[model samples]
Target: MGKKYNRVLLKLSGEALLGEQGHGIDADILSTYAQEIKAVQEAGVEVSVVIGGGNIFRGVKGATQGMDRVQGDYMGMLATMINSMALQDALEQIEVQTRLMSAIRMEAIAEPYIRRRAVRHLEKGRVVIFGAGTGNPYFTTDTAGSLRAIEIEADVILKGTRVDGIFDSDPEKNKEAKKFDQITGDEVLKRRLSVMDLTAFTLCRENETPIIVFNMNKKGNLKRIVVDGEPVGTTVIWD
Candidate 1:
């Protein structure tokens, strides 16, 4: 990519923080993430993050079991707090300056979400993790990523996911599924692609924020995606 973009939002699912076997947070995984982030920061690229709580609480899973939708969403938001804390700690362990900002303030642990302050942190080279999922019910972390991307004026939103790229069919189920290297946001939604929720993609399209969906589980993928940009995954944008 040759550093086509300077600042980006790295949206990581809570599952991405968990290593193979996928139950609890893995120290090794956390360490690897810290190093990847640190390497990027050192390279002079400002990065912010939004972490999903799917590893701990997938909201729909609760709703499917009869939990009230709002309650389930709140549970999912809390799950994100746990991931945010882990990320903050992991980054700090590597001596990387970081800020954990929450939409719903939990004063003892993190600072309340402040757009200006968060921007300042990134400008000063601190990695910021936006947590608590828009602090409202019925909004996915995908929306949170879009919102933060706009607020921070990120060059792009890099959604770190489990898959290598967007496919016509579930690659896990269909070995013949074809992966797309790049596609427009409209095309993604037109085909009902798995890149992101429709609402999230809409916001990005409306605001002209490009998104990169790439496999986050592989070693060195983070750095590679930022640098090589060698058609690593599906890219959704107006351009």
Candidate 2:
């Protein structure tokens, strides 16, 4: 019950959106997600989300054995849009006003990346979900999260991942992996931790934005992290 921050940027892995089956968006899953986000919004936390594309495309899946990395990345960005739309729909179904902003300039389904417009939506108490991964090839959703968080001036980056927090190894795979209760971005970089891509960690560190890497499985995890500040998982800071 010692949380002191407000207005954060949440980054949800595409896999997190998949509830039980762990594939695509699930109804019970999405409904639960809507409720989690709703709880945070009700707490007066300006929330912005940057979703990943891994649930659909791994990029190299569509790439020919010798496909260009750039084109493959473009495909990955588009895949994120699909997930974004699904989230937007789910949020709206629960009567949570939300907006989809794409970095790839897809005016047909969403607004292009506009910093001012995104911040305005957050100020108006609407959740803005950023899609399409920086509108450029060779960039991961992790990078997009960093970029959007900086633009929106978020207090911290809440990274919802498969595990509770950063582990020395894959806790799911390794029987005796070590977990860190608190760590620094420099340590994450020095140790080459896989918690986030190097680009994201460096960008956030440069902007002095702390990252909270936590589990997304619990029903009220999001709200708990926002209000309780009792970190449901590990906190990555820049010392």
Candidate 3:
């Protein structure tokens, strides 16, 4: 009947946008995500999103092929902007208000990332999509998501992945991998579970921010977790 989180930061991988495609974003997946986001927003949930750029380019992968790491990371940031713009366009097409903010100054395409402005946008019920991955090299989008969530004082970080939840091992590879309904941050580190990178995980742990990992591809799953207050995924807490 009531929403679970008042405000949330949704962390999504750029590769998730590749849905059934080889190298680019799928229109169907974009449409589905837009609709899902719209549902939660309409239900009065303040949402902020940070999407990765792995679909287009990965700095580490490029570095192995002889590309300079810093240059490649900047390129990756641009790739995220591309995805962010697409999502903004899709949401606008469906009449959902959204603001695209980038860490890197891009006056033509998006507003510069301003903390107060971002929170104000959220307060006014506009979905804020944060792009460009912290504007720093060697940091993943996961870190950006965690940083923004803390800065915005979001109730939780909803990590929307392809999997249903976090597992002891890679669920796709290990048929017998165990799932935890809820887990502690220390336990996650002790078991070496790959939820987020160490830097991002540390930030969340220090801030006592909770993270919910769930299957983003599943229709109604987002609503179930955010609006219906259903236990639809694995919840990672600091305690």
Model number with the top TM-score: 3
lDDT values of the candidates?
0.85, 0.84, 0.93
What's every prediction's RMSD, in angstroms? 2.2, 2.1, 1.6
Would you give me the overall lDDT of model 3?
A: 0.93
Which of candidates 1 and 2 is the stronger one according to lDDT? 1
Ranking by lDDT: 3, 1, 2
lDDT of 3 by residue, 1-239 (tens): 47888999999999999987767788899999999999999999999999998887742464547878788889889989999999999999999999999999999999999999999999999999999999999999999999999999999999999998999999999999999999999899999999999999999999999999999999999999999999998999877
By the lDDT metric, which is better: model 1 or model 3?
A: 3
Ranking by TM-score: 3, 2, 1
Quick one: how many clashes does candidate 1 have?
A: 0
How do the residues 118-232 of candidate 1 rate in per-residue lDDT, one tens digit apiece? Answer: 9999999999999999999999999999999998899988988778988989998999999988888768877887777777888888999988888876777777767655667
Q: TM-score for each prediction?
A: 0.92, 0.93, 0.97
Model 3 pairs whose backbones collide: none
lDDT of 1 at 199: 79
Candidate 2 clashing pairs, residues 3+ apart or interchain: 3-229
Supply candidate 2's per-residue lDDT for 158: 90
Measured on C-alpha atoms, candidate 1 has an lDDT of 0.85
TM-score of 3: 0.97
